[model samples]
Target: MSRLYSDIFTNRASTGQASADLSEAHPKFAVNKVDFWYPGKQALYNISLTIPERSVVAFIGPSGCGKSTLLRVLNRMNDLIDGTRHTGDVNLDGKNIFAPEVNLVDLRRRVGMVFQKSNPFPKSIYENVVFGPRVAGQRDRARLDYLVERCLKQSALWNEVKDRLHTSALALSGGQQQRLCIARALATDPEVLLMDEPASALDPKSTNAIEDLIFELKKDYTIVIVTHNMQQAARVSDVTAFFFEGKLVESGLTEKIFTRPTQRQTEDYITGRFG
Candidate 1:
């Protein structure tokens, strides 16, 4: 049976245990001893990592190394896949996300995501930015108008498209559309953003724009990005995690991971000796 999104629109307070757990102090996200499977195959094996709040963490590895899979695990996006399962805990702000009480809708609202390809809704730019807030029952026209401008400015696309807010989002260039998507994610006021190779499909200039946005967004939102681009990872991430064959080979400061990785596999992958 599928798991139902708990509590719908109800705003349940954090449990006493959840409140007390906060006293112990932990990172924004704590994935401990996690093992994940997709039907017949295992995708991740006993992975553990901590992501500090208001920082960018990059997962870099060859394709199929489980970087994207782990990215989806953050907000339980994998739950949409049939027969997928995982063991262990993924905690956000000291609360286990897999706990029965976690409201899926709220969890997703708090942890917004962007994909490798820019996927703007076929609607107007204004509509795209206000989508999330509207779905959550926000009806104040003034507030929504404010969100559109604020989020677009935060995404660095306000000046470029401010005059065309009513234009279809698809009318924008690739980079602009991507920024619009970023603005949409920000509209929900998410605390965390999960980006799966967010710029891999864009041109160099567009890629740079996305990278700059990531740098700016990290000041307010914790970000986890999966990228095959080693240079991009090195440039944008505060911390880097290297994975190989579903196992976390090494993870640490980006400088250390790139210049002084302890694991031979990590060194080999980063040095272009092997993927």
Candidate 2:
């Protein structure tokens, strides 16, 4: 049954202007008829969506609804898991990201990801932010230092951590650690940032901090976030996509999805009627 629906969605995604216009508008990241499987169980249906450039698009859905799966597919993070299979096209700025000729290292550099849990390196706050640029062959101290400050400020952590840049990232609170992780992701100067429930574990205050950072960062980088919090989605995203049972139930402007959803399932889920 899942496969049948996947095929139908894939067909519709491929034979229409949805994919084309998505690329036209964003030209940063485009997923067309995307499908994924883990050892024979389909995890994502033909999920097609366009992420507008320098904008935040939030994915909201119940547990096991494939929100995280879809976010990982955008940056090919699923490839890290064993026995994972994927089909269809994901383009970054009009280039096929899944192409054999594409360099995984470079692709990851362009498309950075922040996981649900904050996993900062054991190194100091300064080291975590400069790690990516160093690995990318940036050897100049001046350039690395400049990037470190820029990224930390961009992630809204510079003012808090600047005085102790040499302090270990692990020494910070959970929220600070997450922001450090975000700074690390930004250090690479990625064109697209994929976040999976980035603030799910933080306190309300910390969550607000992250939310504000997302709102501000969208001015420079395109962001795709998977979040279970409906209000957070409404607050941070310009577009909202509702997923259920591995399918894209509906998507549109955030206001529309929250206040006037077109699908009954979407309305129900948004209004606390059902999962």
lDDT of each: 0.87, 0.84
Against the true structure, candidate 2 reaches a TM-score of: 0.89
| Cα distance off (Å), candidate 1, residue 197 | 0.5
Give per-model TM-scores. 0.90, 0.89
Give me the runs in candidate 1 sitting further than 4 Å from their true place: 1-26
**Model 1, global lDDT:** 0.87
Tens digits of lDDT, candidate 2, 98-190: 898999888888889998999999999999998988888889999988998999999889999989999889999999999999999999988
RMSD of each: 11.3, 8.6
Per-residue alpha-carbon lDDT of model 1 for 92-210, expressed as tens digits?
99999999999999999999999989999999999999999999999999999999999999999999999999999999999999999999999999999999999988999999899
Model 1: weakest 10-residue lDDT segment is 1-10
Model 2: residues with Cα > 4 Å off, grouped in runs? 1-24
